[model samples]
Target: MNIVVVSDHAGFTLKEDIKTFLESENHNVIDCGTYSKESCDYPDYANAAALAILDGKAERGIFICGTGIGISIAANRHKGIRAALCSDIYSVRLSRQHNNANVLAMGANIVAIPLAKEMIKEWLKEEFEGGRHERRICKLDID
Candidate 1:
């Protein structure tokens, strides 16, 4: 999978760790950065990652922030971007299976690296049900 990942200063370390882990799992990752732990805005990175998905540069995205809330909100502003903020395996699976989410957002402060890895694994494994769920996801594009 070709995945784009972005993070602010607060999530730099976690983002780097996740990037390495994803790479090891054979995912081609585009690292959209804050670069180091210097203070920086989350929206900039969030928008860049979201644009990668919108522009077809990446198949999926993983965005990180202190709480993941702000970044997810920003990504969701793009039409067709279903950015789901998930901290658990069940939510991660449902996000893909039901929402057909193209993006996953996680809080560096809220989830540990191991748990986040498991959540990502589960998310990648689940396929969208696309029956009644497809009807609901279609509603998300309404103006």
Candidate 2:
């Protein structure tokens, strides 16, 4: 799977770690910026990652920031992107299984590295259960 990841200063280390982990799992990863610990805008990276996913350049995206909320909000502004801010395994699984979320967002300060890894693993492994949930997702796009 091809995945795009982006982060700001607060999520720099976590993003690097996640990228390495994903690559080790044999997934192609595109690391989109704050390459350094220097401060940068989260929306820039969020938009870039979301566009990549929308354009079919990536299968999914993972975004991280201080609290995850801001970047997730930015990513979801795009019409076809369903970005979910999740910190646990259950929410991660449900986000993909039910919501068909194409992007996952996490908080560097709120979740530990190991927990984040677990959540990502669960999220990637679960397939979207689209039967009953399809109607709700359709409603989301209709607006």
Candidate 3:
């Protein structure tokens, strides 16, 4: 899978770690960055990663911020980007299976690296159950 990841200063370390893990799992990862622990806007990175998905450069995205709230808000501003701020396995799986979420957002301060990886693995394994779910997802696409 081609995944685009982005983060602000607060989420830099977690983002880098996740990137390395993703690469090891044979995913083509794109790092849309703040580069270091330098202060930067989360919205900027969020928009860039969202565009990568819209442009077909990536299949999905994983965006991070201090609390995951701001970046998730910014990401969902894009018409087709279903960005889900998930911290648990069940919600993560449901986000993909029922909502067909294209982006997964996590808080750097809220979740640990190992657990986050586990969540990502589960998220990757789930497929969207498209029936009533597809209809609901379509309703969500309207501005």
Each model's TM-score?
0.97, 0.97, 0.98
Q: What would the per-residue lDDT of candidate 3 be over residues 1-143, giving only the tens digit for each residue? A: 99999999999999999999999999999988879999998999999999999999999999999999999999999999999999999999999999999999999999899999999999888999999999999898785
Query: Candidate 1: which pairs clash?
Result: none
Cα lDDT tens digits for candidate 1, 8-98: 9988999999999999999999998979999998989999999999999999999999999989998999998999999999899999999
Q: What is the lDDT of residue 119 in candidate 2?
A: 91
| Model 3 lowest lDDT segment of ten | 134-143
Q: How high is the CA lDDT of each candidate model?
A: 0.93, 0.93, 0.95
Q: Compare candidates 1 and 3 on lDDT and give the better one.
A: 3
Candidates ranked by lDDT: 3, 2, 1
TM-score of candidate 1 versus the correct structure, residues matched by position: 0.97
Candidate 2 residue-wise lDDT, 1-143, digit = tens: 99999999999999999999999999999988879999999999999899999999999999999999999999989999999999888899899999999999999999999999899899899999999999899888656
* Poorly placed runs, candidate 3 (over 4 Å): none
Prediction 3 TM-score vs. true = 0.98
On TM-score, the candidate that comes out on top is: 3
Task: Report how far residue 74 has shifted in candidate 3, in Å.
Answer: 0.1
